[model samples]
Target: MDFLTLDYFIKLFNIILIDLVLAGDNAIVIALAARNLPKEHQKKAIIWGTVGAVIIRIAATLAVVWLLQLPFLLLIGGVLLVWIAYKLLVDEKEHNIEAKPQLWPAIRTIIIADAVMGFDNVIAVAGAAHGSFDLVIIGLIVSVPIMVWGSTLFIRLVEKFPVIITIGAGVLAYTAGSMLTGDPFVKGWFDENPVMKWAFIAIVVIGVILAGYLKKLSKNFISINEQGQLTIPDSIKNEAQIEANDSFEAKVDDQGRIVLVKVAKSEG
Candidate 1:
């Protein structure tokens, strides 16, 4: 259990890596929240907002560490993480523009958004830190600047290559599944059935991917009928190469807003 060992360093590296990858949304939040302020106040807002986020993360990670010590809490957290991943994949409204032209409001929005959206990051980082508060703090310290300064670049990359978002979500799912299997409540069962760990991870990863795929499928065009029911637009069905008799499944986003209307795959 030497803190200076290579294994410990690897864990620390993992914490940093997770922070960098999964923190893109927070960066976007900071940027958008502060973008509406006066030009002179923009930089100040970003700096102070990042500082605020880091402080919040520290408190959140500390709380998660304590909560994780209890039985079954990790399992609950894992479920929440999985849901977060699913939402990340399906929800398309990540970009929120602000035109308030005010300073304090922008800064306030930044902090509030960070607080609301930070659970996924805090839990993922806490899991990667492996219960080391020092590791968590150091990891956040090292990665927050990259997110704050490099946010525009990261956002461009994510937009150009949407796979990055999927990858980030997958990472969250993997962390969540790992936490579930490693939770004290189920740790003994997993120890006795060693294969269960890999099985759990596989299920989580595949489930996430499949859910995302289905969400994508829902992007097909549909018409809202007089009764408020969804129906495939005849022209769109022909364009989509879908058969007339094909069924569709509507997918709702995290906020219960329907995003897409997709034709159900026919059973052979």
Candidate 2:
């Protein structure tokens, strides 16, 4: 119980290390959930969402022992995680960013996903802490900054290379499958039948990825009509904040590429 002992510091370091490694999935969920929001509000969502998720983690870590005893806890959580991964993947769009996105839903997603996905972290940290609540508190305190930085970094990465979202979803699905296999009720069976465990994991991961890809690809097709005049699709226009009768200046650049810029209205 001594705060300054080497053992205390070692345990704290272990807790921090565990959290750092486990934080990637939480960061991805935050990024994917907030990316569709306006740039100004994305920061708010990231910060608030992370705070809520951390609070949930703390509470879960505290009750993790008892929570583990609850029947079907891992099974139910794994199913929910699979659904969340699928939802996050399919809901993302190239031109479907909302001008007025709901903040709470994104925060809610972050909290629920983090809580479900955090069981590993909680158990890992709890084992490291050796029942020391003080270590738990300090460890979570140190993790907040790391979690925020991770979320922002992922958001930028997703902006540049969107495949990360799919990868992230696969990661979630894999974790979910692992959770399912580890559930107490099923763990005995899975241990006796390891091949079935691998099959279940493969099915969950591939099914989520394929279903999300197909759903995302099902966006409405938009094309110019035969009149030679291009009309903007409502979804694209709304995403771009283009109003009816909006004027655009088109130019052919040195690369022989066409570019369009919206013209600002003049004051009377």
Question: Hey, what RMSD does candidate 1 come out at?
Answer: 9.8
Q: Estimate each model's TM-score.
A: 0.74, 0.51
Tens digits of per-residue lDDT for model 1, 14-34:
676567666765777777777
lDDT value, candidate 1, whole model: 0.77
What is the lDDT for 243 in model 1?
A: 75
* Candidate 1: regions farther than 4 A off: 1-10, 95-105, 221-268
Please list all clashing residue pairs in model 1, or write none if there are none. Answer: none
Q: In candidate 2, what are the lDDT values of residues 55-139, reduced to their tens digit? A: 8888877776356446687777677667866876766323222223677777776677667667667765554455578888899
Residue 110 error, candidate 2, Å? 13
Error of 1 at 32 (Å): 3.2
> Using alpha carbons, what is the TM-score of model 1?
0.74
Model 1 weakest 10-residue run by lDDT: 92-101
lDDT of 2: 0.72
